[model samples]
Target: MKKSLAMLLAGAMVVASLTACGSGKKETTAETTSDTTAESAESKTVSDGETYKIGVLQLTEHAALDAANEGFVAALDDSGISYEIDQQNAQNDQSACQTIAEKLVNDGDDLILAIATPAAQAVAGVTTEIPIVGTAITDFADSGLVESNDAPGENVTGSSDLTPIKAQISLLQKVLPEAKKVGVLYCSAESNSEIQLQMTKEACTAAGLDVEEFSVASSNEIQSVVESAVGKVDCLYTFTDNTIAAGMNTVTMVANENNLPVICGEQGMVEAGGLCTYSIDYYELGYIAGEMAVKILKGEAEPATMPIEYYPEEKCEFVGNEETAKLLGIDISGLE
Candidate 1:
């Protein structure tokens, strides 16, 4: 009886040990599974079928800005990434830009696309956390949007619509070789305009052409300001000024009535009524910005480190308005 009892106790001990071993194995498997789940969560990116929200704040409604907006959308559509976009236009109003920027921030968008300098400035004023991709902007560092073109050092980076200034000036000289004085027409309110104005003056001076300033504080003053420049200067040169771009009809009309040749900064302005430009495509510029946006979303890059982009110079075209050229009776045959 004693031997049987001892054997039974040993058997019971063995069973208990087996049960404990099974529990230990189960716990180890569970820990490994938990670690793997955490690693997977960390590795997931926007490309992993996660939907992203994008907000676009455009400064105004005009052909150039419109084309940029369209190109940005087209890029996202082609990216095959799931996303929802909220587009807002400021109508060239700074107050409107501020309001829309605040709304976008409160709504928690994954990213924001600022179409112009003012819009970018508005968004930058509101948030430093949200990634900002700007287009139609000349100099990011000069605009205080980024720390540098090579390394943003902040949450802002995008393509610059900085057309070849010297090239445009050369084209102007080619178009009107006999002209001695050029009127630099732009909105004084826009910082970008001021920056371009200074560059234009330098370029004109270097080319032995005198430049006269014709700046307007608002679109309301465009007519009077442009009229004031009609006989004072030989030709009018306007850069990528948003205010002038919005009021191109008035600018071209007044200049045209007086037979003044207006050399524009970009293709849209030339298309609207100006004579010609060594122009950069705003659509292509925006597309470049959009591509940058994709990398940011995919966790493949960060705006703080992404270099500012620009449309290839080789792709820039010398766009001219034949009708405007005909109206002004200028020989653009040399351009062709």
Candidate 2:
């Protein structure tokens, strides 16, 4: 009986040892898995915490372009991504744009935001490796900045500030029913202006109104151009051309003095003393560009495949300058 009891005790000891060994093995594996999971999470956190360097090249300082820059920065601020920005303005100088573009590229920026067509072109000319986002541009495809609006097929994409030219012409007809001759004025050097001019010509022809075009190479000739158009055309039509937009005061002063109501391309021009416009919100356009930049930075999207974005037509506003209307002795009450 004693021998049997001892044997039973030994058997119980062996079972306990086996049970302890199994429990230890399971505990070790669980601990190892927990440690590995923690390390992986930490690595991911470090990668996400990296700060991005962004460069912004703006064409010139104006109400529309300034608003675009503000909106772009606002988007980046809202994105929760840590970033450093190098903001540079070309002051409407193409050469300055080229210099700034080169500087930004040399600085090794991760991404670039080009405000206008010239700025975008400058940056694109500098680097094909760096991603570029353009805003306040009329048509990316027309400007040769992209292969197509639907598929950029390159490392360039953003929002287009292409306002409704047809609607604008209709507005012009509504405002000035008796006016027969319309003078189209824009900067000849601006590709965006050229596109708008073509659309304006088509729209004017369809409306059965005689249209005349006046092109300026630079802002230096704005005064002379406006004076030349005074007696020939009943109303002057200006586009969102950066050159003309910058010198809008001179253009409007001349037109207002001659009692020729100017139909502007944007609210900034209207506010600067033009008559009216169907204007797109440039700030919203920039915000859209900013969102695209965020997607590119996060690897969520690529500029090569991203289609150019546009503000919805419903978002456009029919804006008129009341003071200018009063000066021109024209009634814009119907616009309200």
RMSD of candidate 2 to the truth, in angstroms, is: 11.9
Q: Where is model 1 poorest over a 10-residue stretch in terms of lDDT? A: 35-44
Q: Model 1 compared with the native: what TM-score?
A: 0.85
lDDT over C-alpha atoms for residue 317 of model 2: 93
**How do the predictions measure up, each by TM-score?**
0.85, 0.85
TM-score of 2: 0.85
Off by over 4 Å in 2: 1-48
Per-residue lDDT of 1-336 in model 2, one digit per residue for the tens? Answer: 999999999999999999998886421111111321111111011124657778888888788998898898888878887676777887888988888888889978889999999999999998999999999999999998999999999889999998888888888999999989999999999999989998999999999989998889998999999999988998998878899999999999888999988998888999999999899998888889989999999999999999999988777898999999988888898675
Q: What is candidate 1's CA lDDT for residue 168?
A: 85
After superposing all C-alphas onto the true structure, candidate 1 shows an RMSD in angstroms of: 10.5
